[model samples]
Target: MKPKAPNVHEDGLLEYLEDIIGYKEKQNQLKDKLSERKKNMLKQNKITKILKINMENLLKIIRIATIFRGERTIRFDEQDLIDLKEELSRLERFLEIEENELKAIQESLKDMR
Candidate 1:
């Protein structure tokens, strides 16, 4: 006796195809988002590195100035003090902005997952 053929439902096929397409689209979107996030993180990392270097240099300058002051060999003019204060304030603002941006990115990543 010949074997009977199996039946294939068109509706099931359509549903499966739709699901696959949706899944693939979702995957592509995720990949794009991850790539963009990685690039942004790398850029941020570079900025952080530069900021770190700047902080270290600033600290070193302050330490040297302190040592010189202790020895009574150097004096900070009013303009010099004002400039240093402005620079420190600028750095503080930059750090606050970066922190907030990082927090936002973290939230976005969590939402993606």
Candidate 2:
């Protein structure tokens, strides 16, 4: 009996199956990465929330101490006030940076959709 020739349709079908498998693998990898990114974003959000609350509380305490001195006057010297102002400025800068980073991440996620 003569040798049989290879079938072109069978070869095409095998190639198509391999492509499908590759596509699915890539899709799964992307899905995992997206999940990780979302988790990271959630962590960042929590950090940002904590920072905001701390800043607000710090401001409130400063106001209450400085403005609402009733019996015993609290003495905050010039240097002390200056140091507190500097610390507040540092916190503000840090919060701004974190907020901008989070906003960029959110925008990128939106774009991916």
Candidate 3:
């Protein structure tokens, strides 16, 4: 009797290669998306840090204004107060925007995972 040819399909070589290729494609796509997200996150974090620093500076200015007035008549220049308030408001708005961006990036990362 002649010996039978080997059953190539039974060895699963082709199937394994196909799976590996598919997995590699998926990994590449995920890596690209992750890199983009990381860049965005870094940008947002930097903005947040800047806004926090500005807010702290505004608070320090307000404290100094209060300290400058020690008598019963504690008076601060209206324009100074207005400028400080405006700066604080701007910083708060910037912080909010950065926080939202960070949250969105986190959500996207979670979905990808």
Question: Candidate 2's residue-wise lDDT over 1-113, tens digit each?
Answer: 11332574444654566567785576566667667766665676666567666656765676677677652434554345556666666766665676666567557656645
Which 10 successive residues of model 1 have the least lDDT summed? 1-10
lDDT for each residue of candidate 3 in 51-80, tens digit (9 for 90 to 100): 667656766766776678653322455455
- Predicted structure 3, TM vs. truth: 0.45
List residue ranges in candidate 3 displaced over 4 A: 1-16, 19-21, 69-113
What are the clashing pairs of model 2? none
Q: Candidate 1: lDDT of 6?
A: 37
Alpha-carbon local distance difference test for all models: 0.62, 0.61, 0.62
Indicate the worst ten consecutive residues by lDDT in candidate 3: 1-10
Separate clash counts for every candidate: 0, 0, 0
Q: Write the per-residue lDDT of candidate 1 for residues 4-105, one digit (tens) a residue.
A: 323443345544665777955775676676667667666766766676667667656766877877863334543455566676667667666766766676
Question: C-alpha displacement of 107 in model 3, angstroms?
Answer: 15
lDDT of 2: 0.61
Candidate 1 RMSD to the real structure: 8.2
Give the Å shift of residue 52 in candidate 3: 1.1
Q: Report how far residue 6 has shifted in candidate 1, in Å.
A: 16
